[model samples]
Target: MARMKKNFITSLFDTKGKSQDTEEGLTKIISDFFSSIFSSSNPSELDILKASKGIKSRMTGIMSEALGSQYSAEEVKDAIFGLSPTKAPGPDGFHAIFFQKAWG
Candidate 1:
């Protein structure tokens, strides 16, 4: 009985440790993905969050210049990904308001 209990606890710890590692790996992937998105012509997360407050933010400016004046980031994202705005979860659990512009 004692050995069985020890084995059970060890197995549980192993499972927990594996899950934690997986979660960390996923987080890193998410960070890397964001980095790639902003690697060229686009600003980083800090820049996006900074521009979240205005109608004429960097993202908006890009959209207006390329996609047209009425283009919004949400629309651009949807068009690119073929999904609704909600499909792309923002980085760090917060949305970065994007104004459309073509730095690309």
Candidate 2:
């Protein structure tokens, strides 16, 4: 049997160049760093409806209806075939070539 080794942050340096090894000190240092990054000054509020009042959509009713319609089998097959075969595998661990060859 093989033994599993665990790794963790043993120590961290604070902004003042002091090493923090205690749990509380490490937590405080990390929290302060993230807080400094995420905190915002002079935040502005926007009214979305007022901002979008003058913006006009370019799509026509026919175009909208076509977009909402279901795709045909030929279209789906074409899309699969259009993908590059040498590309990296998807999240399911299968490449585009696999699908193209299986269903081509």
Tell me the lDDT of candidate 2.
Answer: 0.88
Which ranges in model 1 have alpha carbons more than 4 Å from their true place?
A: 1-21, 41-104
lDDT of 2 by residue, 1-104 (tens): 12333456779999999999999999999999999898765444555566777999999999999999999999999898999986999899999989988994
Which residue runs does candidate 2 get wrong by more than 4 Å? Answer: 1-46
* Full-model lDDT for every candidate: 0.53, 0.88
lDDT of 1 by residue, 14-102 (tens): 32354224655656655766877868775488886777757554566666678655778767666645534344456655322331233
**Estimated TM-score for each candidate:** 0.20, 0.54
RMSD of each: 17.2, 8.2
lDDT of 2 at 8: 67
Q: Which candidate comes out best when scored by TM-score?
A: 2
